[model samples]
Target: MRSKPLLRVRKTGALMVAAVIAFVCAVPLAGAMWQLTPVLLIPVVVFVWAWRAGTDVYADELRVRALVGSTRVPWQRVSELAPDAGGQISALLDNGNVIRLTGVTSDNLPRVLAAGGQQIGHSDQPPS
Candidate 1:
């Protein structure tokens, strides 16, 4: 059990802001046009995806949460964290499968590593 709340790593905060803007814009259109009410679904989905997608670092394990589901990997199971071609960070698991950390990127990898209780070296990036 962790004494502190889980540490989180997320994509740009811009996503959530966009979701809010979309919802605000849709509200008036939906109320006036009536037919635009169904359009509200778009912002709702965006809000869920933007707000829910991220990785949460717990004491014993790390959870990669997505819009629809989540996957938890124990610290011992992670062999390394590397970036994909798209520059998104991924975890190379001991079992040989790679788990793409949704909100993790090279720039934020160090923070994520620290939150996971992994020590960072002098290098700008984690070990390849």
Candidate 2:
């Protein structure tokens, strides 16, 4: 079967919070007669960060393109799949790298695990 995205989620709350903090930080500088050019980048950075927070897991490849960078793991390289207590699903690779999937829903977790050719375990927590 072709790999498909089981879930897509962004950190909207965190982004908004970051934007607010950036704005607040800029206000003081703006009042001090200082240019707020640097501060303006904060909101943009926050937006980019939020936009990249989404996770994608497919049958043949598991990809995560977050603030750090993007990684594509072929199914054959996946050693195990585990869900943490916080509802984040982690794909453990044969190379010992773990890609955590956030913002996944309970309904989609089953399909993702199945696509990865792994069975869900008792400790597996449904995605949030």
Candidate 3:
């Protein structure tokens, strides 16, 4: 039997907060310093990144999203998964690249693993 689809990772909350902070700082400055309106690009870029960037874990692969597109890494390419110092989950790929999962944390690592088809064997489930 197939399991339900993996839920999307949670990064939108941070995006909303970042958008608000960016506008608050950029608008007044842009109004007062018309010539420096270009400076607002910095915050605008950050807001766009926050809105566009995210990671999605699937049964067979991991998807990393960006403003314009996304990249998919199959489970076979995943060599390691662990929590980093800042609490984000990081993956070491067989290609020797380490990618930080945008919305995943240590606390949610087990869930992500299960969604990726790792046998988590939770005690709460009855043994087959």
Best-performing candidate as measured by lDDT: 1
Model 3 error, position 17 (Å):
1.8
The total number of steric clashes, by the backbone 3 Å criterion, in model 3 comes to 0
Pairs of residues at least 3 apart in sequence or in different chains that clash in candidate 2: 3-59
Q: What is the C-alpha RMSD of each candidate to the true structure, in Å?
A: 3.9, 5.9, 6.3
What lDDT would candidate 2 get against the real structure?
A: 0.69
C-alpha TM-scores of all predictions: 0.79, 0.61, 0.74
Q: Write the per-residue lDDT of candidate 2 for residues 19-94, one digit (tens) a residue.
A: 7788777777867766756776777677667777666766567677777787777878877767787766777889
Stretches off by above 4 angstroms in model 2 are: 1-7, 13-32, 105-108, 114-128
The alpha-carbon root-mean-square deviation between model 1 and the true structure, to one decimal in Å, is 3.9
Candidate ranking under TM-score, highest first, comes to: 1, 3, 2
Cα lDDT tens digits, model 1, 1-128, are 74553688777778888988999998998999888799999988888898889988876788999989999899889988889888898899998999999888888888777777887546678789
Each model's C-alpha lDDT? Answer: 0.85, 0.69, 0.78
- Per-residue lDDT of candidate 3, residues 31-57 (tens digit): 997998887888777777777677777
What TM-score would candidate 1 get against the native? 0.79
